[model samples]
Target: MNVMPLGEKLLIKRIEAEGKTAGGIVLPDSAKEKPREGKIIAVGSGKLLKSGERAKFQVKKGERVLFSSYGGTEVKIDGEEYLLMSEDDILAVIE
Candidate 1:
């Protein structure tokens, strides 16, 4: 399914966490923590400013980013998990 975010919002897919420990011990699904890193799937147009000019975004689509751990609303699209969040929720680009 195709998705388009509106007004500085972004659609992200979380990167999966490794299931094994450094010692090679396997962890159960319940023991896995939700990953805070994600890839940007879609991006919205820049936010509108008071002067009718749009504010520029520091990040773009397809960039990996780190976000606030508790930020963003969880969503499911085409049976896949995704997050819908504002650009402000993003802390840094992963490079």
Candidate 2:
């Protein structure tokens, strides 16, 4: 399913947390940490500028990014967790 975002919102598919611990111990779902990273699936048109010019965001589809731990609205799509947020909520594009 192709999902498109509207007007300055970003659609990010959250990466799943690893289920194993550092010591090779298997961790349960309750032990997983919220993933701070995700792959950019879809991006909205750039934010409109005061002069009416749209200021485009640097992020693009397929780019891996890091966002604020507390930012973005949680959403579920096709039974998978995702995040929808403004470009400002993105912290950095992971190289």
Give the local distance difference test score of model 2.
Answer: 0.90
Give the clashing residue pairs of candidate 2, or none: none
Each model's C-alpha lDDT? 0.95, 0.90
**In candidate 2, what are the lDDT values of residues 1-95, reduced to their tens digit?**
57888878999988888999889999889979999999999998889889998888889999999999988899888998889999989999999
Kindly give the stretch of ten consecutive residues in candidate 2 with the minimal lDDT sum: 1-10
Q: What lDDT score is found at residue 21 in candidate 1? A: 92
Stretches of model 2 off by over 4 angstroms after superposition: none
Question: Between which residue pairs do clashes occur in model 1?
Answer: none
lDDT of 2 at 63: 99
Per-residue lDDT of candidate 1, residues 1-95 (tens digit): 89998988999999999999999999999999999999999998889999998888899999999999999999999999999999999999988
* Residue 43 displacement (Å), model 2: 0.3
